[model samples]
Target: MCVVGIMVGLLLLFAAPGVGSLSLGFLFLLGAWFCLWFFPHDLAHHVVGRVLGVGFRYYFLGRSAITN
Candidate 1:
């Protein structure tokens, strides 16, 4: 997911010749790219699971895993 986000960011930058000159905008774009990408990454798991007819008892990450 991180790799995908980074690749998209870099590609957008290089693809537009003058894009790198806008420093603040570039940073904001990267931030938004990662945030938006995360949603579909999590959703992909659920969609694929149902399509394959496999069930996950539960899923956890970060601090949630400790309590779970």
Candidate 2:
């Protein structure tokens, strides 16, 4: 997330005149989308469980995970 923020900041800083605002907004939106894509709730818990060497089961409602 920090990296994405920094990248978007840099992109806005270097964007061409008259288009920087649009570019910045687009970059921010893209960053958010990618973040959600990479960190889907169930996968997040699964990853955390693996890091802690514990077993986990993810329950989802529609598309969101319910973590216990």
Candidate 3:
């Protein structure tokens, strides 16, 4: 999900300039910023978990982990 969010954020950022409307482009940029900001911490958690051999099934409310 973090990977997907990062990819979507990049896509939005790239597409923002071509949107042709200042307001719409700003919205896109904002969305990109949000996506870029939101997902990385969880990704880092996953990375550390993998390094420690701790597996997770999903997040609880996006912060708490539900491990498998």
Candidate 4:
């Protein structure tokens, strides 16, 4: 998933500048931003935390307890 996201992001980054329409290029840039943030960013955080012996816990935020 991460690899796919990155690939898509790279494609968008490259494709944006060459687009003939300004609105289309802007949309591509927004897509690239979302892809970059939504995929590899979280994976990277988890990887680093593991390497440093940090533990993580997930919890719900709606009328429930949250943990770290």
Cα RMSD, each candidate: 6.6, 7.2, 4.5, 4.1
User: lDDT of each structure?
Assistant: 0.64, 0.58, 0.90, 0.86
Quote model 1's TM-score: 0.48
| Winning candidate number (TM-score) | 3
Residue 37, candidate 4: how far off, in angstroms? 1.5
lDDT score, candidate 2: 0.58
Where is model 1 more than 4 Å wrong at Cα? 1-21, 63-68
- Model 2, position 40, has a per-residue lDDT of 59
Give per-residue CA lDDT, model 4, range 1-68, as digits (tens). 77899899989989999999999999999999999877797679778999999998882335436577
Identify the runs in model 4 with alpha carbons over 4 angstroms from their true place.
Answer: 54-68
lDDT of 1 at 30: 66
Ordered from best to worst lDDT, the candidate numbers read 3, 4, 1, 2
Q: Could you tell me the C-alpha RMSD of candidate 3 in Å?
A: 4.5
Better of 2 and 3 by TM-score: 3
Residue 5 CA error for candidate 3 (Å)? 1.2
In angstroms, give how far residue 14 of model 4 lies from its true place. Answer: 1.2
Name the weakest run of 10 consecutive residues (lDDT summed) in model 4.
59-68
**How do the residues 1-68 of candidate 1 rate in per-residue lDDT, one tens digit apiece?**
54566567566545544554677666766665665566567677788889999988977676543453
**Per-residue lDDT tens digits of candidate 2, residues 1-68?**
44565555455444533354776667766665555555454566667889999865654447536587
